[model samples]
Target: MRASVSTGQDLGMPAIYLHLLAELLNTIGVDEQDLLLRVGLDPARLQSTNLRVSQPQASEFVTRAIIESGEPGLGILLARELKLPLHGALGTAVMSSRTLGDAMELVTRYLTLRVPHLKVSKRENGSLAWYLVSCGIDLGPLQGFIMDAMLFGCVSMGAQLTGSVVDGLRILRRGPEPAYFQRFRARIPVPVEFGATENALVIPLARLSLPVRFTDDQLAASSRAQCEEALQQLTEDAGFACRVRRVIETSYPFPPKLARVAGTLFVSDRTLKRRLHEEDASFQQLVDRVRLERAADLLRNTAMNLSQIADALGYADAANFTRAFKRWTGTSPSQYRNTWKAAGVGKKTAERVPVAG
Candidate 1:
């Protein structure tokens, strides 16, 4: 399978981040599963680190999560829970970086791999270095929540990378501080300044040389290579074909029709076909790709029988599903499940296993 999607437009937020937000909602006594379903998102899809939820869907879900949880500071809470490894390859690259400066540079270059809407730019002045963060899209109500998660997440990450909070670090926010910030202010390691010209993380120039706690030169090189490849794939996947795939991936009733997928993307059938062809993709190919992925996941993780799995993937019957599975993977669905089970891999482990294209 391809390591990442190839380029045209912004693909969307990584599903893992949304999954983390859902977990936060659960901790706050909200029915996160229901909230996701109501927003037309599949809870299962969020489990895949490699998948991305479309921007509109992700925006709606986050908006509702805030309203339902009645917590505007959920972003800060979310940041506190962001362990380094949850960031995927970027996390690995950062963790294994030689110095805080190197890690921050990696983040500035490849943050789009994780958060499509946000970008970080570096500016240096006498004695101080500022990492200014700005959003590429109009986040509106989500602006505060995202900024809180991002800037605080950086603070959290920095503390994790270095054994201590680097001296003289601070956070800058553009608007007046929100009322809820007081609840988190005590836990935040760095001082925050409000009513600033831009949102940024400020640190002394000398701190940039602070060595990362877990730096490994070999791991750093390999992971940075992975980040570069992922970045390329992400940029390549931004085209019309990718947008259509996003629709199909999240659509209800499994294996959505071409017209439905096209309509969802606001293009007619002919135009959709032409655009996808321009990207060297086809409607059925995209649908098959999604089906194959879902099929593999269901086979490995669920005890659902072939018949049930067939129905789930919109196949006519078990035989058809089995044949399709064999065609896609060179093995039948039952054999696939048995092989995975025989390996003693659990559902959680299976879920983390990236499917080859």
Candidate 2:
């Protein structure tokens, strides 16, 4: 695998790490390839650094391994083999930071540099709560393919930093269906609630002062500096595409102009365009992506008409928006909206139309 320095140590894909360890175990006579096979992962992938194992595949592999090995800590053991503490540099850096607010900011800011399909936000409304908001990077709705562990991991990262239990945790699903809430309670002592408006962790802001064991100023500074370097380094990596996507997504409701994004990144428009091209993208591609995402949101969450959606995306007219939408998704705007509506989404219709042209 062409591992970039900007990968931020986490490897992003834990399943790949476990597969590598399984390969190592095979060398030592542990034939865990069968276990990996049982979980639908290719043992050949273990040798390829370029391929990644899916989360569900990894979870099943470990679960089966634990059953066969009669070892309850198999998951933790594989995690250790992956050097998770070091790979979890963002979490470790937050734990080493001087203050809770700074730590939260670091995690929120550099997460995408490490993880995929995650958007984090911190709000201090009387108390501090971090929202692990998911944008549809997985090409599905937030709840469609979200990993169950992510909810726990989000809270666990914060609780580990503070060395204090979380006050509460929330999940923004419309219905309560999972029967494993008790299992979650065993892993996370905090109260967990589903059917909330959004997935978030409600932690007390004052707990930010709680002492952590690994508060190394040098490590914190080094990690923060490395994170910034990694981001700057991404200007030359595949993740440069993600940065362009991010800029475009944030600039939505109105299509972001090239100069504005260039200014935001402190790079010239020409330089930004050149870099994006090198990363196999262009400003127009990102804009189209932003429009598609917004169009999906409007179709699923609002009652916006096609004309209004087109106008919001900076299209001259509804016909143009429909053409662009068809180009991006191979479906007409009205067809897309009707499909989602038939799926029973957007129970509450928006009074105003979305202009995600």
Candidate 3:
């Protein structure tokens, strides 16, 4: 019941990033060593198509490359290298999308398949302003390195489709780069903020309706059915924990305690035990897993204290919450807060545990 998205199955390496990286390096006259240094990629791992790169690594690759290459106007540099129409399978899919909105939906929804570690979100800020937000755990040291390529690619594709420029394009980076602000305009006339809310692409609402060549009930139905089937299979495989996570997400601000959750699912407390038994999970185990995930997000994103967090998570008291937090992570809430505070990372709760359907 949690309104969260997940992959039914993990896809292999993200071809988009790899392709873009190859093109980008070639365009800039940067080789494997340059890329390896930028992305923190091991030389041996670079050759494998199946090797996965974390979002952080992708970010690092782009961020560092700009700094190291002395190509302050890096977005334009990479944009020049991208052939938006040549994205092959991905391009074909977008070309078939019904509306620009629909095309964007498909791309972001399936971005995980292309790059499993990166999560993308789109939000309407005003009548004509929309933000395409991308965030995820960085792949070690390569935080934000590939972002320049990815953002430029998006803009390039937009321009190719409309044969014009986006009303605005910008970036919110992890750290300050004095030259980047000037370079941003040279590449695209959008206002660039160094430490903005998140990495996002701004688009006009009018452009969202621009016609794309791709659309068919048949394709939509098939894709939907395949996605549904895959999700169902994953849920079955993960068993009760999946259901429990779903339940927690859906029940946010009123997350069900064990007894209440069991009651609503049409099972007696005892029956709940038996079912979880068959699934090789206990109610407490499910709860703990959900709580740990939720806690991680909160610690990373919020200033809520131990007591407030504990209370929010349905803990009996601050002490109880601290004990549980220590168990879930190796450190206590205070220590975690102190470390991240020193490191200058913002905190955010992952999301409420997902509730079952």
Identify the superior model by lDDT, candidate 2 or candidate 3. 2
The segments of candidate 2 whose C-alpha lies over 4 angstroms from its true place after superposition are: 1-32, 35-88, 139-147, 167-175, 239-357
| Per-residue C-alpha lDDT of model 2 across residues 4-112, encoded as one tens digit per residue | 2222221134234555557555654667867665544545434433233333333345555545665443332333233225335565677678766676688678865
Model 3: residues with Cα > 4 Å off, grouped in runs: 1-16, 31-76, 84-89, 168-177, 193-195, 213-357
Which is the leading candidate under lDDT?
A: 1
Best by TM-score: 1
Clashing residue pairs found in predicted model 2: 1-49, 309-356, 312-355, 313-357
What are the per-residue Cα lDDT tens digits for candidate 3 across 1-357?
A: 211122122222333444455556566676746565433344433333323443333344555665666665554565555663444334555655667767677667665544444666777877654445554433433324346556666777666655565555455554565555563566454565666657777677877887754466566556655545543544354454444444443332434567755643445788778878888888877777757766665676778877887887788888998887776676787887677678665543233433322
Q: Provide the TM-score for each candidate, comma-separated.
A: 0.85, 0.46, 0.47
Residue 196 accuracy (lDDT) in model 3: 64
**What C-alpha lDDT, on a 0 to 100 scale, does residue 264 get in candidate 2?**
44
lDDT (Cα, tens digit) per residue for candidate 1, span 1-357: 212112214467778888999998999999999998787677877877788877666777889999989998988999988889989999999999999999999999999898776889999999999999987666556667778888899988998999887889999999888898899899888899999999999989999999999999999999999999998998888787787788678766577789866655556899999988898899999998889888887887778988999998998999999887788777777777888889777545445333435
